[model samples]
Target chain A: MTVHAPSLRQEWQIGPFRKGDIIAGLLGFLVLIGLAAGVGRLFAGMGATTSLTDAYPWGIWIGFDFALIAFSGVGFTIAAVVHILHLHQFQPLLRPSILAGLFGYVAVLMLLLLDLGRPDRFYNFLLFYNMHSPLFEICWCVLLYTTVLVLEVSPDLLANLPWKWPLRLVYRLMTPVTIIGITLSTLHQSTLGTLYLNMPHRLHPLWYTPILPVLFYISSILAGLSLGIIAYKIAMAVRGQKENPAIAIGLGKGIVAVALLYLLIRVGEVIYAGELPLLLTWTPLNRLWLGEILFCSLIPIVLWATPSLRRQPWVHWVAPLSALLGVGMNRFNATLAAQSAPTSAFYSPSLLEWFSTLGIVAAGMLLWYLAVRFVMGSAVKLGYEQH
Target chain B: MTTTQSELSRRDLIKGMGCGVAALMLSSAMVAHPELAHASDGEESDSAWGILIDLTRCTGCQSCALACKETNDRPNPNQTPIGLDTDAYSFVEEKQIENSVGQTESVYVKHQCMNCLHPACVSACTVGALRKTPEGPVVYDADKCIGCRYCQYACPFGVPAYEWENPLGLIHKCQMCADRLAEGESPACVAACPNGALRFGNRKQLLAQAHAQITSNPGRYVDKVYGEYEVGGTSVLYLSPVPFSFLGFPELGDEPNPRYAEAVMKQTPAIALTVASVVTALHLFMQRRQQVNGEATVHITSQKPGDEL
Candidate 1:
């Protein structure tokens, strides 16, 4: 019997990028740009381009951008659990986790710039330090965290480099920088949700709690882990590598644990807030809350908890995707859905807004594709070296 | 000699028990009135800047809103004329409340920056874009703003509006007409109020006036002044015959908004550091264990086992 030992140096040849990949990426970027331009032209001066009113001030830009970025917390959390926690068996999953985190945060930054009425004035945040503002805290923490992420990911580049001096410098800086990055990421990830704590009146009672910041912090850890698992499965499929059953099972267990905890906390919050009565109310807010809890939290937990179901290669993909979807739904509910109560003027997003959001996401995907191809190389190679 | 002994015995017992009870009472009083004991040796004026809005007197005419726009030179909501947008420094919202008679009454509540003593927007802004002026107004500086709009999310009132339409839109909100205040003039809305619905004055004076109004007309107003204790007290105060919630006002407790965000910022770093340190220690331990085992651990194996590359 010929046994094939997995080796990093072996090159698996996939067919050349067909015309489709380039055209799709290019077209997606173009469509994104075109939508942005349209927003500039038609709604450039009109404040009405968004569904936001005095009643519902934040719309998709904030809901999607902030939530997605917070969800990306999976990167650092997984890296910490695997590298710092000494889960060597989870090593194969680390690179993709970092990559997802990088992409998620980059996307958030881009969306922030795009969402701003004046993207250029963003430097003022750095120039003027408002020690008191939660925004100021978010700005500094996010900036420092992004820099840390780059540094944390730099060791990968260093490991691949031919020279010794640069790699040595990176190695020396790696532990401290990684530690700092984890710290910064934790601060901003939770701060993003805490940013809304003051808006006790604006946020629906079901979503608003003094403990929201802590909840956000905990949820992001779970969300990040789930994202890492999903990214790994996708990478495996793309590379045609056979699934490692142990890692998959480990991730499944981790996600189930997080899901259960998240659900319990969410339930506890609602009960404490006396918002349990809201669940019975036949309102859109109640429906959204139900959907987030049911689809994102409950279903994913059940799927991941069962060992036989979790071992299936298809389950590996489904579990993470479901978990992420649940994360997305919860974030959206918190930011947009609950805020869209009927009492306020209804805000329906404009086409321009939709296209701009889509464009930003596509740009993120494009960046991810390029980074993976040029910087990280093939999944198999990235996996072996990192291990 | 017998009479003297009896008197001495009673007097000695009284003195000992009396001192113990007095000591307990004194300590309890100090605990209850620590502030009184710490009160200044010299008298100081209780001066605070505040605003008082009489909702019953307000007609919902939106004259104050128009005055605010004109004074601030804010753009018109409908047109793209040079600089005007919905950047009104102040505006009035009409909230419909059903009375006991089941009749809908529209109450015009003016909305602007609350200028809290401990403003959440001020704390939420990392770049010092939003500031609580020492004089009491929570002001915003566009030049210093990173356009994070965290102030928008952090504000319990939802006061700050982002210029989502402009390529250079900074956070635009009411600055309590800080420029006018510096000139010793009242805010545009206060001057434009036809019924004296808006009053701007030192916070102590405003609170006094608000309390007097409620006291003088017990049946005419709600007993509570809205901003006196809400979110650590705002410069803006409101009096409503109807409940504050019915006037499009949110019910918030007295705790400062920044406390929540601050709590997270305080605890996260320690937790993250602990996790990172543990991971590093484990990595070192595993590597050392492999070394001690004297067996070459397979950290990485290439696809082509024979090929060096």
Candidate 2:
């Protein structure tokens, strides 16, 4: 019997898996487990499957949902930079960021479905109109913007098609579609903060402000740009190509500017709202609030603003990672920690909740990796390459 | 980069500034007069029904809570409810308040939906599932509820409860017996009250009677009615011997909870238009500037060759 070595693609396809394959397999396993856990939760009801109580109606599902939506701002944010602002130098990162945005939103939609008690009627927002409701506005904006993201990211796949007209059509409609995406993102991103406006009685005084919409919108941009750098680096690495350091540096400058503004307004709001005293109280909630600002805004601002630190190789990964964590913490804090339960009942998400959430997120990462490898490889060759 | 091009940019900047000023002015005017942005509940106030609960007369019999469970067809109808839940729509809370001489006094307070004229839940519900009716009850439509539980955060009184035990749960809350009222019958809780603590009547008349009782017997009741002006008034009014705050009622301003949120939401269309037009204009302006400068072709991959209209 003659022994033959398997080709790279064949090896990837067959049983002799490599590192990437092992990672993909692990993610796939988690996704399958998550599907089972989700089904179990759906069949068993919220009371049995989750630790959520009437006192704390929302949990990790909502926390991740809100954070993922903010992270997905990369789609419109990068599009606005390249197509709208005409910053052509940042073009290389565009497609990858849009792909990231698409999957981020898909993951968010999945979490939302799992969170909804009546998941079957998730489309009810379309049939009913409540112009006065912040949630109503957010629902419409998310749905429309997800559609916009699909269109924005379609060209990556469309480029691979044998037909030419579909790609041409998408490119022709790109500008207006991008503008619409930006508009929708602005509405929902800010409206997420507006959702909290109704909860003055429940939310801690430190996080509750009339300017929450402003803060939320600004942070989305900051986090979006931060995530964009990470996405660009990973995309380049996946394609086995070298990345330009200038891309991260340029985006870092923008992140710095946004971070400064966020920090100023956040602290300024606290002082203006006369909640500075609460900040000094040393309560657990106050500590969490301070930590969020420190991680999400203050540290990134310092790291990116300082020339020497910004150039450091580690700063590239550390700063953006911290910013992402900060934003995630902010969302979780807003959804859970800052909320004051009327009763003594506390919440700790069940194992099923953890497994299911991890599974959905893992699936998104796996899908993004696969697309970046196969679809994006050819798509980039077809002239997404920088001149 | 030329002087004439800079001058043209200045001119465009001025035009953009003009639009910004106009938008700011328009927003300020809307802010100055909130009534311009205030969307009415579409329910006539004149014919609204209300409940008057005189806590000074409640005996803590737990009869109203049981009757509410029975009327709503909730589980364990005979069980005494300790708090608001999917099973119990209303419950009487026992509180310990200090007397003027510093002696502790026990007071019984009934807890249920406030049914505010400007209900935050109705304003925050994603699908218009919750509605403030012309007859003054804040009702819910289960079929329309996606069970997002946004209402749980929006309610000032923390009234709405979710049936967590159900596979496909829906929000459950005290609807003030809108169905019973339709049939010219009072709420089961009100009718079942043995101490005459709960009164069902026209809201305006109830307000008048509540004030009359306060004035007629000095020191018997608090000078203020609990729900009369709380969150822009509720369909239910409460008369208490002790302060409502001591009974754990959320201290609230007269302005409704949804006021700021609704005002911002009402600007959605305006915000969307402004953003779209500004972005479109900026793109056009940048493309024009690049063309005027005759810079080597702009290399946006998304805008490469086929993107041109």
Candidate 3:
């Protein structure tokens, strides 16, 4: 009997392109542009169009963009742990995980530009350096990290492109670039949480601690790992591939471990900061605190720890989705709900701000779809079955 | 073959157990040194700077706010439409608190940058746009600002205000009149305070004065000195007759914000580099091993596979 080796190349070929993808992306882009223009008009009139007041200087732009991006630090945290840490089993989820991070950060940068009073002067960040500002450190690290991500992910693009010296150089340099990327991501991700240290008076005592930067880093990693698992499941389903049971189970266990650690640290923070009394108070803010701890952390732990649930396909889906929602809730509470309390008068977001936030998310998803179609066709090809 | 499979499974079990143990140890270590876990390697500034607000003497007159507007050249808040307005740098808020005698007494709290020894806003500003001056004021520079508004979010005091109304918005806050300090004068608000409500001096001296006031008259003031050790001590200090919370002051712990970031920053480089190096080495090893085994190889084939040599 003659045995023929299965064709790996056949399964991994670039899929056919779809014009509909580009049209949808273009439409989303146009909508985002329209929303941005509307915001521009409002700013041109000196923010008279918005409901923001002196009592609440920060609105949705800061809450969603800054706070949300900080939460999304999970992306880099997971990428670093799985890719750089040599966790070979996690290789299946790395591409999509990093892609999500890329999109999240890009969304942050876009929102930042829109939020700037003088978006034109944004380049001045490069020209001037305030050594005293934590913001200065954050800006440089984020910019450098973004470049590093592009370089690290470029291999995917280079693999498809006609081979050239430049491509070879990039492939050769990928290791160092990835190392630098990890370093930069770590610095800026934690720095985002550290930014709140100065406003101990502004943040609620229950949420505010000296260890927030550490907490932020830990939570981000937990969230990132969970998000990666969720993203992989979705991507695999969309491309019609059988899920890797081993990877799903491995990540499920990882989530439980991280969630337990996060819960312990959160409880420790409340105790160390002498905020246990605040937790007993029956205010709306206290309820948010409870929700963040119970829904975002505790329930996910309970769901993932069960042996039967860990093995189920739906568990992988539900676990990560829950973790993502939990992280989002924690970030929102920390940024808006926890900070703005005792008076609802100071915390309501303006209509334009809300529209702009929704537009950014919509536009990000649209771009992601196009990028996946064009730049990341291989990601889909990875799961093709052998006959 | 069955024996080999069992041996392989055993090895896998051992490896998994090792990972579990390592994770357990890491978590324990992290819990023990929670504050030190994320410490970044940055030079801690030599001189800790701050401010002192004497609430007992404040008259609730808006003179300091007026002086701040004039000094900063901010727009008039009253004339400018609600959302369009951006004038006051240091404003006073009135709060009615019931004392031990159960009488409602109105208290005025002056709000401004606490100028934390380890300022979160400074850490939050990725571009180094907002900084803590060595002389003890948290200041903002427009040139380095990408208008991220991270400073606004990171500030526990909620002092950093964005000029959202401006097409080219910049962050606005009281620099404690840094320019005036450079010229050897007190902050505009401090100099303008009619009743000695705001005092400008070296942080050490101000702190001593605050301690003396609280110690000398126990019942006259709260036992606490507001910014003395909060958030690793602030440049600004506050003294009040009522509880700080009742007067709108946040109850902050002693740990500074930078300590948190610093701890994580310290561990990240080590972990990241180690992981990257190991992964790179593994990848290289696999590639070399495959080449030697003659199982998988990179071939630069010309044309399609069927047409190639």
Candidate 4:
């Protein structure tokens, strides 16, 4: 297990800034400026600045938070497998997953601040805690879990340090931190769904179920497996690393089992709750609901369930991309469509909103590139070359 | 926040951990005493106040709306067609309905906050910004409010209004004139009602009076009292000649809004702690077993890359 330090010349002269990077940086800068102005006007008045009304108090920001967190499920899933679950094979995927999660959560915090009518008062969740509110619990879990994540990812940032004692201490605490991170992620992911439980009539019949928390938890696991696979493959492709079939097939099989279980529970819930009747009545909402079921769950479940299909390289790549969309769309539907049933209020993210979302994602990608190319590059390079 | 290589002290860490534990204990204690959350069964026992709005007695005059504004120092009413806004605390809605004689007649209904026995807004508020008092009013403390607007979505009646036009946003809703009630004065709307359409009294008395009116004159009033059983009985009671649904009230069941969410929330603390402990224990066991067995726990297949899934 010998480590090779790159030459100073090699470190200084990696790939020069490309055209795509320039364009992305320019776009991100413009979007950040707009976001600052938008946030400024938001203080002037939420209703005046955004499309948020009393009927639709939450707009794209809340839904965007849900989507980002849902997709970030890969981080905890990978960490648990490697550190706590004792599956040493998935170790290489851990850094990328952690990077994705850290950025994803930072984006969520940014969006939440923008959405809040009084963003400055967010700390009140800690100071004047109301334990009854699911939002309160979510705040606590997010705050605590993010701390664990920072600690878990700290070793990567500090790997270049001459001293070894700090790194050893972090390594010793890794198992506990991973356990805590999993706990917090599990609670908050489910609690986000619990926020909807208070308003059954507000949620469309398609999503209103007592087992919403259970659904959220299980689907997150499914999303974790699929998202991790997709992220790993994409990173490998970007770095010119070959595919790891062991990792891909292992994740694909897990996705199949979880997807089937989630589909089963969701179907049973709707039928038992007498909402299956809505499926027959074919309204636009019902059609969208059907689409979520068919595309997100059923198709992916079948694709991953087949052993031959799982083995194929195309399926290995495409199935995860499909699953990411499926899971992301599910979050969007739950956050927007489910809550919009009672009122006629409609929301499409403003041009500014869309630009801000794009900017956040681009910023995340840029950060990932910096971390990998500068800080964690050698580790990733070695992992790819060896395994 | 930067600490030198050896400047961090053990005492500092212990002090920080102690504060953390105290905060956690305080929050858990607040959660454990569910009675504070159940306002109707706790501090509200002295006198559960209520408002009885008799639609049969209402003459469509906008005096109540006017009086409410004057009392609350609300802005000019620019209520939308659907009614309810930051400026207007209450409004009169016009509805066209056919009478028993089959002739269409316009009915004017007054709308305001329901102030439910178990208010979803109070439950939804993460910082105790909205609260239910024993004197039978759901109050808003803007000082504590984070302007999350979750109460806006949580309220069944859509009662809580956001000051969206203001640079500083906060919730606005009818607090049933808590100050007036304290001073032994009826609400401005009730006092100003020229037609005696609104009645204020103890909640039990209001319920009894509403029932007597329904049972006494069967055909004059509808069989159902609008808020009597809706969302687990609001503080406001309504009796109408026409079905309440025609006036745009949501058709809700008797179960309260809090009851639904509490069903899951009640178990969350236990579930979260239990899951955390169980998972940590399992992780430790695996760690110990891996140490003892030395690379025999997880079996990765040795088959070729093209092996079947």
Candidate 5:
């Protein structure tokens, strides 16, 4: 195979002051502010830094950590689609989605560090063993899967190196690494829901069910496939190339099936649990539950399933974004709203939490774009085109 | 020659990892199951220590709370703590209840850790930082705790309180004076109770005494003991004139809180093996189909650089 050396300096050019630079600049600024906020939180402690109390030990940090992990399912989900299922027509989207997954997990790790009361003991989960704990399993899976992700994305980096052997070795190992990643992801993504199973007393009945693990796992795939469409479109745009419309349409079909199945089980469990009456109550919590179903399941299913609506260019963007938002809301609602605190005290996040959360998100976007513009630009396409 | 050898090695690697992951998960599941199943047993041992609190006794006296602070060496021994916190491991909750004649009356209920026989916090803790000891106290090891606070959600009684004021905080709860028990003294709260409101004894004897008190004192005490069967029996028992729910005790079932979590957790190995097997099977099937369709296997390094999609 003859390798074409990329024209490196041209891709790195930022002096023309384009729109991408401005977004990058803004994200960079937010990241700086977020770093400062994180430092303040670590120094002053949770009591002074955030509105979190004993009544609300977990807040937006956990909410996003859970959501991001779901979103990051793009890594394994897409890997499964292309490598495992041998659907190579979707190959161009793979690298970008995996990169997004890596970034999402990194942001989750950062937020988790901030959320910990003892951030210094972040590695304590590794030292301790508690197989009975859902969190313990999640901790181990996240650590292992992150390593798998680093290896998955390393090919792009290795291709740029003077030595060719590293890339060759990784290429040979891709099939096993991908399978391992999917297996590990299956454990933790489902286990995130299992984390909530312990809190049956605290969680609202409408959202709490014995099948929470199943619900969480399915929604992750829904979110992952939706994000894949977005990632593919964005990656094409970043590369200054036109996207194949067939890819998004194909993925949209997959989303509808998963969304319908998810809706069935999610609502079916509530009925099975005899909590359907709770859904009709229209209490604030009930309304939130209905909203989750509407956005997460109803709207995505309708938007993607209808042929006329699916063909519209705008639906392409709106459908997937709607699914992503619904999944995000579900995670946040599960983490915060569904919980019934022992005390009557309500939680409102502090500015520090808001800033730091935004900053971490900004940092993730910035790194993603930088990689998209520089590191991932031609190498991934070249690798796929050759295959 | 090189391509064939590398392909064979990669397949071998896949098979090896699949088995290794399954084994790891299975071994962890095996190690974890027995301990979890044993922990879920709610029946109290004959030798286990227990606390029996009689709420009908004449006192809203905060002496027990003060003694608790002193014994625990918490900061504010003099201050009356209305709720449990890092500085106050135990507190007396004052409630206004209507008597039989419909007139309001004051009742004080002392609150502390229930030390459940099947403690959800111990099972939910990421680090196994909280443990149910054979001596009947669920002790917390601060050194092992990373302060993830999953325990706070797991405790039905809302017992574990975080030291939110500290930058590096740890969970604080009543350890039922394990040190005092070791020294052959009763818990400080029981020792300091001016009235015999708090009784310390072996669980079996205390349970019998509680039943006897209810039977002997015809209409004086509520027939039900609050902790006798709540969340599979708590070490701390309570007797009151009113239903325990009116005094803000959580209504719980006989099934323990961690039952679902631990049960699901024990299936981790099985889940892993099943997933790995299915995915590997699918991969192999896909590869076989592609070969049968007369398509070449796609490898990153095997093709020319400029091929069309």
Candidate 6:
């Protein structure tokens, strides 16, 4: 049954200040200061604020961008499930997830701007289209997808507005908008992996394969599913509600299903590349590479694969958390460490690099919190108010 | 105590260390890979220009490296172009090779962008920032560059250098002194070479000359002429006494780097349309199911569906 506003508002439970939120808030302020200083350092042109050299020009910005995009990326996929598949049971998850994706892409653009050598010339990508370059494709997709996200999430705002007839028209045309959104999401998400395709020899053998775009696309899907479980828990915590066991089990099943596919491709690619020897290789870099795969991937798959095990409340957070961390680590390993390993010296983020990274993350958190609390609070209020 | 913790600063310690670590990392790179920092002394010629470096005749004088650096206005002549923050368009590497008789021979090979006949960097540059000249130099236009660094990744020879320290951060690479070639000047390094090791002329003439030399003096040169069939034939040819890999060249076959991405990307439009159409059909099918289910529920309730829905 469609829920009304008054009862839906009562369904939300506002929680008291938790220990985690207080620490996060305090650290947020510190990172804000650091971010300011880092931006100044960047503009002054007086110093190099990052350990980014020619060999490895990317860092936390590019790496964490992939992770965060995955975290909020399940929106269109969820939208497809509810509106297109007519599985109205999951409709409650759709709007909040789309809003999350919108916020995530905005943050991605800002971080990418800062990462560029000439931050001023970023608009040049629109003017100069390199058809062969994946970066070019990603640039276009991000622009188009952000617009798609706005359209997809705007129906929530329309309901509150005075204009009822226009809202009805928008609501009617939503399937096409959703169709566009899903297509764009799949494109840019996979195109992110294409950036690595040009650097075949530079990228490590374990991660490098012709099907990297496929791996990136699949892993993002699984990661998006994994992050959904966590995001729901957070939203519920904010609204002072308890998580249902059924939802937790369902999310776990989703993770296991997608993760198994990812694992098959990952393992198959390793065997095909004949790079299984890298795991046995005694180098510390190889060990770190092997460790990322073992902890983030193999272990989480084990935990989520069993239905009995997934019923536990801990699996709600644990499996998804591990998947997020694993995919994040894989991205960082592939982009940052692998690129730097061939260099004469190792790469690590500098003081300013750490500062800027933390600042951006904190800023994103603050923005997401505000957007959830104010702009899209009604999403979580839907479907269970009267019950 | 909480206020005191808030007042604490982690600034001064990090600022000093940040600079120190950057310096240390960069310095270690120079020490660990001086060869990477080594400047190439290859010659640039106008009208189908190419260089042939005879490894057998060459004495590793490094005058070519020095002269090339001086001509190009490199701030540091000693450093390798491959090193981070280097502006050198040239590089020369010294490597040891073992003969059949177990005699270890030290070989000095000049290294730079191969300036391929069909350069990958040219195709990789979306903005037309990089292009191969008819005169044989693969050049970079800083004004057109967005600093995506695709060229650096695309180059099989690893010749392009990024200006990491600069705020502008444009890519720097060997342009084969196109300006000097335009003025009808021979390349500084080739002109400066005292040992007669470096040969600068038309690419075809250089190739023919290289083949003639190899055929005449089989013992003096390897049976192969590098750059003749490598990565679709580079403008810069090599006649070496030892294998090219011994002098730090990657064993790239005749295939270009752009072909790798092209094969996949060519299928993109078809794949995209197929996926869209398929997903759309599935969506319509699912919505039809919902409509059918709703009709079934209305039949049971016996109150017409419009009022209840």
What are the interface RMSDs of all the models? 14.1, 6.0, 9.3, 7.6, 2.7, 14.9
Sliding window of 10 residues with minimal summed lDDT for model 3 chain A: A378-387
Candidate DockQ values, in order, are: 0.19, 0.39, 0.20, 0.32, 0.57, 0.14
Assess candidate 1 and give its TM-score to the true structure: 0.79
Docking level of model 6? incorrect
Question: Compared with the true structure, what per-residue lDDT tens digits does model 1 show for residues A1-387?
Answer: 258854543433443665436745785776578457445634453264555554555678777877777667877877776645546677767766777778777877876766655565766665654433446567766777777777656654755555646655654455445555666666677776777775665678888888887778777887788787776765554444565777878877877787888889889989987878788869877887787787667877887898778777787777777777777877887777666342446778776667767776666666655554445443234342333
| lDDT tens readout by residue for model 5, B203-238 | 878999999999999888889998889888899999
Any runs in candidate 1 off by more than 4 Å, and if so which?
A1-50, A155-162, A340-343, A377-387, B1-45, B55-70, B74-87, B91-111, B191-198, B217-220, B240-248, B266-309
lDDT of each: 0.67, 0.83, 0.64, 0.73, 0.85, 0.67
Clashing pairs in 6: A13-A239, B37-B79, B37-B80, B38-B80, B38-B91, B39-B90, B39-B91, B40-B90, B40-B91
Poorly placed runs, candidate 4 (over 4 Å): A1-13, A16-37, A162-165, A341-343, A377-387, B1-36, B40-46, B77-82, B288-293, B296-309
User: Each candidate's chain B TM-score?
Assistant: 0.71, 0.84, 0.78, 0.82, 0.90, 0.70
- TM-scores of all candidate predictions against the true structure: 0.79, 0.90, 0.71, 0.89, 0.95, 0.82
Candidate 5 structure quality by residue, lDDT tens digits, A1-387: 558744566534323445777888999999999999999998898999899887888999999899999999999999999988988888878888999999999999999999887888989987777778899999989998899999998877887677878887887677778887998899999999999988888898887888899999999999999999998888777766688888888888888999999999998888888888777766898888887888888888898899988888888899888888888888998899989999897999999999999999999989998887777734444553365
Model 6 global lDDT (CA atoms, 0 to 1): 0.67
Tens-digit lDDT track of model 4 for B99-160: 98999988778888988888888887888788888788888888899888888888888778
Give the root-mean-square deviation of each candidate in angstroms. Answer: 14.9, 5.8, 8.8, 6.5, 2.8, 13.7
lDDT for residue B164 in candidate 1, whole number 0-100: 58
Better of 3 and 5 by TM-score: 5
Top candidate (lDDT): 5
> Native contact fraction of candidate 3?
0.33
lDDT of 1 at A81: 69
Model 2, span B1-309: residue lDDT tens: 334657756755654554455445433422323332222434437779999999989999999999999999988888899999988899888898899999998899899998888899988888888988879899999999999999998998889999898989999999999999999999898999999999999999999999999999999998999889988899999999988888888899988899888878878768876886787688768867776788643532442333101
Give the CAPRI class of candidate 1. Answer: incorrect
Candidate 2 CAPRI assessment class: acceptable
Off by over 4 Å in 6: A1-24, A44-47, A158-173, A280-292, A295-297, A340-343, A377-387, B1-49, B61-63, B70-86, B93-106, B123-128, B180-188, B295-309
